[model samples]
Target: MVSFGMKDLLTLPITIVTGVYTALKFIYHCFLRPLQSGNSQKTRLDQASLFYEGQAGIYDATRGGLLRGRHTMLALSASHLRILRETAANKRLVWVDIGGGTGHNIEFMDDHFPVSSFDAIYIVDICEPLLQVARDRIAKRGWKNVTVLCQDATVFWLPEWLDGIDPRGSVSFVTMSYSITMIPRFHAVLDRVEHVLAHETGLFGVADFYTAEKQESLIDRSIGGLDKGCGWFRRWFWRIFFEFDHIFLGSARRSYLEHRFGTIKSLNGRNHFLVPYLVQIPYYIWLGRSRFRDNYPLDRSLELEYVSQESPGIPVEDVPLTPFHYSITKHWRVPYFLEPTHEKFHSFTRVFTPEDSMELIRHLEVSRDDSVLFVTSAGDSALHLAINSRPKQIHCVDPNPIQGHLLELKLAAIQSLEYEDFFALFGEGKHPTFRSLLDSRIAPYLSAAAYQFWKRDKNNFSSSFYLDGSAGQALAFMRSIFGVAGLSKDVIAFCNSDTLVEQQPIWQRKIRPVMCPTIAFLLRFGWRVFGIPPNQWKMLLKDGDVSAYVRDTLDPLISKYLLKTESHFFHLALTGHYTPQCCPEYLTRAGFERLRTNKGEATDAIRLHTKSMLSALRSLPASSLTHIVLMDHFDSSETRGS
Candidate 1:
């Protein structure tokens, strides 16, 4: 009615556009623009607080899967604490969870570590909104032990934060969960943590995003696995991607931490953002003690008892006491067990053998009456022979005392536990209550050295204890390699394949390409951690192409034996454990009974020696041995011993 002109209609369209733009601007100002406004001029704490102001409500929901390794880090820390708590009577546990937004990590960790067990839990963060969320979560649980403080992590004084509960710099555990990447002064924060934990036997743990520089030296790169750093592309792409949201993914954060502490354990894992276009993010969880020897010092007396044998001068108890008992006894004056020492013989750290026991048995053609003297790589081959072939007597010996301990545990488990429990302990490769089981049942049958070794490593059972030794590490490395090549599914399928025919196609199609020259180079270098000594590697490459040797050696093992479901070694490598139907012969019920009881229904056939094979053999009478499975003994030997 006012005007019937084209100009008026065009003006209406302009007005509509103006209204939409205003609405969008208002929304951005209210929510998103503030997140991007915290510039370099502002204090880091203020910036963090401003960023998290509106985020705390949705923090847990947003970060549930984006943040990884919370459970694993907590579990490892708690296991470490279990050992400390048992030793310390008067010491009260103190925990300081840095940047514990919304109290989600603590709540998640509650399964592994009881929140109330700590005398105090100080949730420290600069954001009051986040702290309030933590405060509310703690309050709802009616937990009196937890206290939330909105303080700068870089300079927060522990004594003041604790309200004078304890003097300054006294805390047992200081953990940073997914917060180190957000700190502007992370180096200063780490310095503060190192200071706060100065007085106590503390563990400083952190899980955060990081990018590691690529190595120019292939040799160095090969040895530097996930525990060290990432590749060139991952380091660059992730650094830029995370830096956009005010998060830093520099290598300095992790390098500085390692320089400040004695590394106990560190693991790198990838967390996928689950969004369309976002790539997988690499994060690492590290646990360490202070650089000083105050925390968990190497107990000289305990080491002596575990590594030493009963010599003539030392008063040997009729039944060897646990290492804990020896620690309390303080027998520093006891003479160290005398064994002729050689560097080459003592270099191996693996308590278990990587060789396939079934293959060894098949190739050796061992008889029922064979008297076997094996090098005792884990004593698994000996046990297999004993159970399958019913060997007359088996002598398992090693220079490293730890290997003897593993054999002793296996024997004790066979003797005391049911088939199911034994399978769980050794076959499935883990048993949560291994310590309790060892104390109540297995320890009585073990020697002083063997008892102490297993006692020290009792916590290994908390996870896959089978994965603790070098053989496990090799399998783990293989699994990691497969995962990188996106062949994990193919590996699972191959491992689960019932017949050779079923697995051949899968291997050729999906797995063969992963064995490229690059993988071969990396694996050859990584063999060091997998228990292949430098000299042994040289011996393997003496006559043939290294890549061909590796491929020929592994192809049949993986495709034929593993796919046929006859090789538990590869099965365990592919999957963390073995099914009852697919485990080792010694792990089966019939095999367990046969080993536990001989044709005469007795259980004293297997023997373990903690001394060198030469010492053990010299002590035995001549013409006493039949089958000697040296496990490449001459390959590593410098000279013949009497």
Candidate 2:
């Protein structure tokens, strides 16, 4: 129907043109479009709900090799299963592998603990092909206890989700090893977990793609894998695909837990580090200047217009505790290096406590009590302890007014509202009274940091980050607590692993073989010795070298005093471990005073409080304090002394 000359040949038929364009478009999309694999996960990648459904063929053909330490993950999870089920005095538990195909995870655990009698095992996943792979892999070894489910993990109310499972502690421990990175909006999944997990009793075993920091460290390791034809494209492709997961997506775990649970046990369970990208470090920021003329601008989330609504019109109410979904690998890498505080960790005896208040009120001690001032170096708890004790005058000063406000509000919710009701709004069980109390007297002087953490992202399902702006101080404090997990133990471990995200590269390739095996062995042995899970081991060790870099690098004074028991950091507000938020702050002397530092202000007079150290009682004033509670827990006398 179409004979063409040279000119006519240039002009193709509409059908032919359309077909060629369609084919090229497909090829481009498959290779380049982020929807195929992009850094910005929040954006819709394609018209289809299944993000990578069509690309499944290529994904399988070149899905990156088993992630580094995948074997260890299998081994660690299996070991845990063995210790739990087979071992006689263990905490009987159930295993739930979310996104677990047929049984790569459960199979190993089952093989090891075969006679152990598992309570139950649930393998949940979405893709049928993976499920098929899981099924085929699992069939190699039979597991009567395992049950596979091909279903959407986001479905909160799947009757079969945990129907067949039960545990000794009445828990179904869920593990998401390297799978959560695939989830785009993982918050809903978290909400489901919170609702499903039995209250006060359940271990959530989580591991995922490494953080941005780890990934950066691994780029070189990957290079070794690459230059040697070790599959660079696979590593780089998946690594790039996970860029958002390492930073933005994973960041939600911190915010989610704080918003839902109040305290951060682990942003992926390793208690040592504080994630920075989300932590608000002093990095180069690239944000556009706001175009709005008004001081307060509204956010556009599903619609064209919506105000912060923290506005007066709505009559502000506290948000109820809503469980968020953000599962992190137990491996943490934030606050750099952190240690759990030693004994008496949570035992900071507030001068305002009921028992202590009476002591101040008694006898000749009250003779000059006319100027009885209450200074809190504590967080929100100060108000309750102060008001309940009927302090003659309470001058609660906090460098961060937000903490003061929270304390104040906590005091109010305690006074006017109910704690349970307050908990509903904030999801935290501690004193709900702090919010209303803050609304009244304390709201005026909210700290700059607190305002940003609490109010800036109101609709966001996350925790407030007081550690970002004050990270330098927080880092200084963290090193003081957790004794660098015996890093020699860590480094030796690094040398033994098969595939670690190596940091340095040798100039000579011949030198490579020696380094690889040495590093691999070090890694393997470290986990074996320390009794740390593979997930946790990765969190602490960087480039297979776990020597506490951040902690050891602190100013010499901080490094020495904080770790050694001689320091007063022991009797402070550490959540059972050393953390960034626990350290003392020079910024909020008033707030720190109210929370009441272990010793009074670093005033010139009390500077001699230290018994052994050269440093004097530094930071505040003795005049700032009106009373002190002396508990004789020290060595010399029966009671403990500071």
Candidate 3:
């Protein structure tokens, strides 16, 4: 029987067909569509391995939300077992928060659940910078039970870390708080947790935006928001500009990275080799989220939209002014600021105080053509720019609404709540505080977390202390909060980020000793440069030993705060226009302003004109107006953060 053998199966016709299909596909990809894929680059199967190493740098700054809430979640989930100092013995509770950046959760646990006894905390993450920060933070806290490591939850699971340095069956609770979503293949992490969990009795929780396809489409659409109205020119320019990141992380060191850290596990949706990473840019952009544009406008707009829709009884026009409207949670993060900044160059030398704003505004005058934007000008800084503009179309955006609203309320309560009233509101100290009025005023609006942290002491220090969470500046608040219980500034500073500890929370400790030098160097450099004055190096990692990698990454602050504008980037963030893409002040550079008549896309409008020489000259028009302030379209798009 002449059976079709291997050679016979390779018929000329079949071979030709295969060749034609392959050739056509190649042609289409090469000629028809644009292809900037990095398919040739090494595939990343063990993503955590690469990412865990990078955490030492990205920690704290990039981690979504502060580490405050995560601890509460863990403590709440604790199975009635006393953590750390249990009343009964042998009922040891364990926790593993995968992808937990910086191990702040551990301190949270240590702070609140001190009554209970814990065996260990396993913090897992893929970025070394973050892990290092986590380690440094744990060390400062003086936590003894916590442990951290930097291994991919997929492909390789460290049994010793999971079980114990002494015993193997001492596991308890496992959590994933917004960390797993950043991972490509989080299943491995989940599976390892399941496998090592203290059986079915072990507690498992995930405080993540667990979107099941429906949420995915919502996420995708939200991400695609960056594409809408981006215009071809801006889109193309950004596509290339963002690609530099791909070259640095993937293209340049593809092989060496793979050999050194194994490989990233999840490369899903990789339409382009660089697509996986590049896609974030468009998503970032389209959400109308510019680092320059404060998110209050978009966030508040959406919330208002939801409120307006859900409560048909309410009119859209009434939403802004209606007392009932503010009572509702609708429109949480709207574009409250008129214009914002979006320059990568701005983050370094950001406008820090109200004085900075005035410095820049001195050179100009505002007229009909000029739409002036104040980074934040309703309260303290507002006092600076208020006189500058005649009609006053100033807009305000701050993150801590409790704090901001308190400021707004202060005026209404002015004479009614005078002198000591101000101190009583925020003046718990032996001396009078500048924020005395606000402290008394914002008492009702404290967040559950803020309240929880503040509850330990009955001497309510006032709103200014709790309002210390100035965007990119949290040290003051930490100091204030710590001071309430008699913690000294030096001890607080040391405890805030002591890098001397040997072990870390599960979120940090990614290094294997070999990477220590590089880690220390970078830490030192980042603390010295990017760490800023108020934030201090210790705030990031509490480390005395700085690494070379961290040191080299430090760059000078690029954004300048004008003493003239009565607006500063810090104030803008306080007002709520904080994002990485742009700063509100950047729009001022383009000659735009904030006025009652002013509406929509300040930075973008100016950017379009700036691209053209004659048009930009025509747009501003030789002092047709007196002063020009720049702040528009700086905040980037935010994913549907459900």
- On lDDT, the leading prediction is 1
lDDT of 3 at 565: 31
Give the clash count for each candidate: 0, 91, 156
Clashing residue pairs in candidate 1 are none
Q: Please state the error at residue 162 of candidate 3 in Å.
A: 9.7
TM-score of candidate 3 to 2 decimals: 0.27
TM-score to true structure, per model: 0.51, 0.31, 0.27
Q: lDDT for every model?
A: 0.65, 0.34, 0.36
Tens digit per residue, CA lDDT, model 2, 111-178 = 43452365666677765655666666556666566667766666623334446643222444566655
lDDT of 1 at 239: 89
Could you list the CA RMSD of all candidates, in the order they appear?
15.2, 24.0, 26.3
Instruction: In model 2, state the lDDT of residue 312.
Output: 27
> What value does the lDDT take at residue 71 in candidate 2?
36
Q: In lDDT terms, how accurate is model 2?
A: 0.34
TM-score-based ranking:
1, 2, 3
